[model samples]
Target chain A: MTGTSFIFWIVALLTVGSAAGVVFSKNLIYSAIALLFSLLGVAGLYVFLWADFIAVTQILIYVGGILVLIIFGIMLTHRITNVQLSHSSIQRGVGGVIVLVIFAGLSAMILNAPWHRSPAIEPLETVREIGRMLMINYLLPFEVASILLLAALMGAALLSRKTD
Target chain B: MVDLNTYLIIGAILFSLGMFGVITRRNGVAVLMGVELILNAANVNFVAFARFGGMDLTGHVFSLFVIILAAAEAAVALAIILNIFNNLGTVNIDEANQLKQ
Candidate 1:
């Protein structure tokens, strides 16, 4: 196997394993910490796909911002050490069966689909291209996203405020 | 080199796992985490297709939007979870069934 393929295997394993931990771990804090590693692994996958800009954004927005928010949520709502924040499964057996079937079906479909393949290009510096596209073809959505973020921020502040 | 099929397969597994988490877990926060996993799985597909299908920056742009939307959704969802906790005294979805009875 080539070095690239080896690296891909390693990264994919880390990503999937940590993601499983995020779902299966008993403690909420452990799940959140697992999510941190999972996000980091996804960022590494983005790099493999030559999306350095998106990778950085993934780390920044997910690990740096959202994870902190989740931790804060845990702290504010539950006892720091004594509370058992593990989630109980309601219909775990059925859920597992369904999940396995879906995974099988999706794997079959992906493997069988006649996906069009183009010649692989060398990874280019995409940050500049992304910035240009944001200002040009995607200008409207760009502005809309900023507006959405602003609205969400204000709405969250409003929702979580202490009511007198 | 790893094939596109490999990446696609990984995405599928992640998406299914996330779906399972959403279906079985009772904690509202865990449910939100599951939702985030699902979104990330979709983002993986977007990026993979963009690279292998000869598309330009469309997939990347879509993934960027997905990331922003996930952040916004998480904020709102967490705030809602906090409200639920404050009013109901727990984050378990099964326990917050005031409307069921």
Candidate 2:
């Protein structure tokens, strides 16, 4: 295999393994850590796909921000022991079957689909150009999204306030 | 064959794993993590299609927005989770069935 293919395979394995761990882990903390690995692996995939900006954003927002919040949430909420959080086989079995079925169907569809490609793999200047397009064509949605985020922040603060 | 389908398949697998986590996990925070994974899976497909299909970065731009939205979502969801913890003292989602009435 070429270096790129090898890297892709490695990242893919890491992502898939860590993702599986996130589902299988009983300890919420462990699951959070596994999710961190999975996010990192996805970042690697982003790099492989020539999306440097998105990869860094993935690490920054997901690993740095989201995973920390999740860990903190787990710590704050769970008074039980990690061992006690372990679920029964019934839940796992049912979840596994559903996921596997969905996965199989998706894979079959992807494999069978006729993907038509336009020959423009010259690594378009997406990050630079998209910034321009966001300001020009998608400016309204961009501003709306910021407004939404601000509203979310306000709502969150209100919800988390300690009523003393 | 070294194209969008490969990446799409990877995204699908990740999404499926996320779905599995959401279904099986008892912790609300873990479920949120699963949701993040599902969003990332979609981002992967978007970027892949952007790259191979020559859509002129629209897919990549869409993925950027998706990432930002996911971050905002996680922040807000975690805050809600904290609020729930302060009120209910547990993050186990099954306990949330009290709201089913």
Q: Among these predicted structures, which one has the highest DockQ?
A: 1
Interface RMSD of each: 0.9, 1.8
Task: List the candidate 2 regions with Cα displacement exceeding 4 Å.
Answer: A79-90
lDDT of 2 by residue, B1-101 (tens): 35788799889989998998888777788889789889989999988887787667787778888988987898789888887777777767787666787
DockQ of each candidate, alpha-carbon based? 0.80, 0.70
Q: Residue-wise lDDT of candidate 1 within A36-116, one digit each (tens)?
A: 998899999999998999999999999998888888887877877767777677899999999999999999999999999
Number of the predicted model whose lDDT against the real structure is largest: 1
Off by over 4 Å in 1: none
